[model samples]
Target: MSGIACAVGLLSSKCILSAQPQSAGRILLQYTAVRYRRKPRWLGTAKSKLFRVPERHQQVEEEVAELKRLHNVYHTQMKAVRRFLIDEVEASKLVSRAGMVIQTPEEEASEWEQIQRINEEWNRKIGEVREKRLADEREQRKNYILERLVAKEQRDQENRERVEERVRLEKELARNYITRDNIDKAIEMALVQPMSYNFSIDLSGNIRRLGEEQNQESSN
Candidate 1:
């Protein structure tokens, strides 16, 4: 018991040996009173007066600085945490709102109307293309017919020129036929001329062989 009391440091060995349970409790109570007796709080004048030792003043300053540092660190961590939570909640709400959005009937109808307008524009463009194609076809056909007519007129002119040229050659042959001596000579001349020249020669030259008739009259 004495060793225990000495180890506790609150009581002497003699008091511990002499004490009963009531006396021990009284002693503990007295010790507690002494330990808890109200004193001036160590701040302001009280701090200057009570904490006279350099060690005590240094301990108090270190404790205060440590507490301030911990408080600043805690506040900074709490601010970051709060901002992160707020941002996360806002993002979640935005995503949820997006997922929940539904198009109004009026908006849907407007979209359909816009689509129909686009389709109508497409049809109009197609119609314009078809009309242009038809007009182009008509213009091309007209040009083709005009070209054919011009070609036919040119061919007709060439044919008429050929007929005129043949008639001129036949007149030249007729002048030669009168000078020809005999039927064999006329036939030989016809072989060298065009067919039109041959047709221009007739029985008039045969019925009146120029020299044969003159000879027959001379004989009569």
Candidate 2:
């Protein structure tokens, strides 16, 4: 095609109409009118010697329809791109928020380690208490057993001493009774002797001796 001509021959090719919507529309309309020639019906008539068919206005409905289809397609594509961009932004925000809320593996591991440490410390303390308690109980039992042994020894000694004392007392009583019976027999022999025999009594034993009587007879 030839370079598109303006409806007005005076219009310059350097003119640019991108300032406002109204100006851009006017320029586009003028450009369309010139590029697609609108022919009048009375250009060739029968009076002319060389008769020719007059030009008719070409229907540009198909071009307008094609432009509309392209416009709609481009608009839908741009809308899809904008929606995708918006969704991506929202997803990024949500990901950032989730990062703020959720704990990382390292942090969770550290927390679990702290809990284990506390539990281990408590277990150690409890073990110490239990061990100490058992030691005390063992000591108490040992002391009790020693005390019982000592008490038993003391009781056994006391019982033996009492038995010995009872035996000694019985022997002392028997000796005293035998001594009294001998003194009585000596006194009876002394009293049975005649007075002419000159016998003197030894009062210490309540009895008289034969030597005293013989000595008195020899003196007489």
Q: All models: lDDT?
A: 0.72, 0.73
Lowest lDDT block of 10, candidate 1: 28-37
The TM-score of candidate 2 is 0.31
Clashing pairs in 2: none
Segments of candidate 1 deviating more than 4 angstroms: 1-101, 104-110, 178-220
Which runs of model 2 end up more than 4 angstroms from their true locations? 1-101, 104-106, 173-220
Shift in Å, residue 7, candidate 2: 99
Please give the lDDT score at residue 52 for candidate 2. Answer: 60
Q: lDDT at 165 for candidate 1?
A: 100
lDDT of 1 by residue, 1-220 (tens): 2343324444322232233356535632222212223332332234335556655445688889999999999999999999999999999999999998598999999999999999999999999999999999999999999999999999999999999999999998887564546778777777998243222334566554456567979999
